[model samples]
Target: MHYVDLDKIELKDIPKISDPDGRGNLSVVERDFLPFTIKRVYYLYDVPSSSTRGGHAHKELQQFLIALSGSFDVVLDNGKSRRTITLNKPDKGLLIPNGVWRELEDFSSGAVCLSLVSEEYNEDDYIREYEEFMLFKSS
Candidate 1:
C-alpha cells in the first residue's frame, strides 16, 4: 500500500455533449483531466448479478471506473476505513488512486464498466491480500 487518503477517492464528472435531436449524450476523457497517463483500457460486461470484481490494492497504478451502461457499486477500503460509491451515471466516474482497495458489486443487468488504467497489465503491481495491504500501509 502507498498510504493515500481514502477521502481523496471520489466521483468526477466528465464533460458531456448533449444532442438536441436525442441521439444520445457523449462524454469524453482527455489527458488533462486525469492525474496519470492512461496505458490501458478495458471494460466489464455481462457479469452475473452475484459476482464482484476487483479485490486488491495497487502499488502504483491508478484507475478510473465508469458505469457506461447500467449501474454498480464500488466498495473501497484503505486499511483503516472503508466506503461505498454507487456509479449509475454515464457522465460520472470514480477515480481510484493507488493503495486503496476496491471491489465492484451489485451490477445491474446489462451493466458495462469501462476502466481506464494508468499502467499495463502487471501482476506484481497488485496487492491482492487484505492482510498484506494493511501490512504494507503500516510499513
Candidate 2:
C-alpha cells in the first residue's frame, strides 16, 4: 500500500490537437501518447461537485489517474498514513500502487478524470469496504 508521488511517476504526455468542426473546436488524446500497457481505460465524467468517489482499494492492479479537465483532489491512504493530492494538469498523473485506499474528492464542475489500469476489471481484485481493507491489511 503505497502512494506513488509525482517524483516517482514516469509521466508520458498524452497528445492533443485542435479540431474545429461545425460545432466547435476540441482536443483529443492520442493512443500512442498514452504509453501505458493498459488492460483497462476508463473515464469518470459528470461527477457531482458536492460528492466524492472511489472508496475502495485494489489488491493487484496499478492505476494512473489523470484529471483531463477541471480539477480534483485525490486522497491517498497507504495503511499507515494519508495524503491529499490536487491534480489539475493533463500532463501529470498519480500512480497508485496496489493495496492503497483512494478517494477522489472536491471535484470541480465539469471535471473529467481518466484512469489507466494495468489489469482488466475483476471483482475479486477490489476491496470495496474500508473495514475490510484495514483487516486485510493487518493480516
**Steric clashes per prediction:** 0, 0
Stretches of candidate 2 off by over 4 Å are 1-36
For candidate 1, lDDT tens digit of each residue in 24-125? 888999989889999999999998889999999898899999999999999999888899999999999999988888999999999999999999999999
Using TM-score as the measure, which candidate wins? 1
**Residue pairs in steric clash, candidate 1?**
none
21-115: candidate 2 lDDT, tens digit per residue: 65633444445544356788999989998889999999888888888899999888766678888888776777777888889999999899999
Off by over 4 Å in 1: none
- True-structure RMSD for candidate 2: 4.0
Per-candidate TM-scores read 0.95, 0.77
